[model samples]
Target: MIRKLFLIASLLAPLPAGAEPLANKLFAAEKSPSTQESMPIGTYAKGCAAGNVELPETGPTWQAMRLSRNRNFGQPTLVQFLEDLSVTATKIGWKGLYIGDMGQPRGGPMNSGHASHQIGLDADIWMLKPASLTLSRKEREKISSVAVRSADQRSVTKYYSPQHAALLKAAASDPRVDRIFVAAAVKIAMCKTAKASDTKWLQKIRPIYGHDTHFHVRLKCPAGASLCQTQKPSVSDLSKGGNGCDETLAYWVSDAYLNPPKPKPSKKPAKPRPPVKSARTYVLADLPSQCAAVLSSR
Candidate 1:
């Protein structure tokens, strides 16, 4: 019958509406935070933040860069930590700090760059100690952070200064900070000058790729934040009680690491499987279930 054929065709046709939109797109559309109580749900790279507060575009000692991204929002604790760190910058003889991306208005996967900022606890503090905090929004967009690591990634550049080390020391030493990510060379440079007996804080400064321009700061889950997940502690048995200054650290800066040999061609075609999704391709269902409630909230 005609009705049967129509039903069969309907069943065969693709239903775009049934396929949910990506979490990044949904979250990116949100220009404000949820009304729910503050909470960082799930892991850093695969979660959503509720009840985030915006850091003022311009502060007395800091200016949030890339204002047009509208990513100056974070949890209350994160905002406070940045404010305090800006003051710390002044004490270290720097003018102040040039803060970078904190999180989206309602923390979730962003349209581009950074996976860990999905939660409200991570922020990027620029290496360039602010030339001036009074810069206009347009200037903030064009002004670039200084690269402290060399192009070869083996050493720190001339731009690296004593005050820069002081800032890192202060930030890593903070109790509120869970960890800080910087270029391996920067960590190596810091390792060279650190007191032999006082390298405990250095343990928190992790070596990672492409953080020469700015350091990424991740804060601890605040007290009684039941929904928050704490990142696993660093496992570096590289030195005396693992301060990460041993030969193991050198591997990251070696030529082998910078230019590894290309893999040999496979004899057989690789089996296709679901690729690991990153922030760029995350969907609503890929995030925590409570995120639905958060997104739906007024």
Candidate 2:
């Protein structure tokens, strides 16, 4: 019996060094194990599933699906959001407005599957344009000029239009917005417009370093996919002083306001030649004539 037990133990022993294990055999198994999984966005799932919408997939996925050329209207939720905003703007008497630069739809090189615009959920509404109105090139240029000229560097609140303020307020009130990146000046103007109750939404607008050209609206990624990678909302460090919005507004005024003072180029001095050492003196009696001749030759 002892001999039989020894034989069984030897058969079950680990393989020797440099030897391969059997392909289908298990050497050892753990009694307990741990696994990791990511949590899906429940809020997004609720909205998308109820709306009968699939999150827009652009780039390679679109190409693989062979629907590459379809005009992406944008994510259904985003379109709905825009519609709500547009209706509000119209009621308030804003005109000549249109969405701009939705970027490439899913499956284009420009989109690369991660573009905010490609998801059909993000749109750039031109602040300079009025709702349902079109502008000639010259007229558009004039509006740009007015935006620059009218902006005040000392006090942004003084120059911000009531129309612009209302638009921001409407966007902030939306529940789906993950965050909004606006010019510092615009953010400052928003703080003034925000009442105590509106502070919650006002806080969602994060002031980034360079948004003078346009505001960037980022939406929360819907559930069940890996694409949404936005960070959690935190109070903006830029808004700490209560003047960051004003500072940002002032900074966006125009070329006159935005441009920093040019630093003067520094001049370099001419390099000097290193000093030459004096020749060592040696008496003819202190060295052989041949050595002296060799040294002289060297």
For lDDT, the strongest prediction is 1
The sequence of per-residue lDDT tens digits that candidate 2 reaches over residues 102-132 is 3222211121222224233454555553422
Please report how far candidate 1 places residue 194 from its true position, in Å: 0.4
Decoy 2 TM-score against native: 0.48
lDDT of each: 0.88, 0.42
Q: What is the model-wide C-alpha lDDT for candidate 2?
A: 0.42
- Residue 218's lDDT within candidate 2 is 55
lDDT of 1 at 157: 95
State the lDDT at 84 in candidate 2: 67
TM-score of 1: 0.91
Lowest lDDT block of 10, candidate 1: 6-15
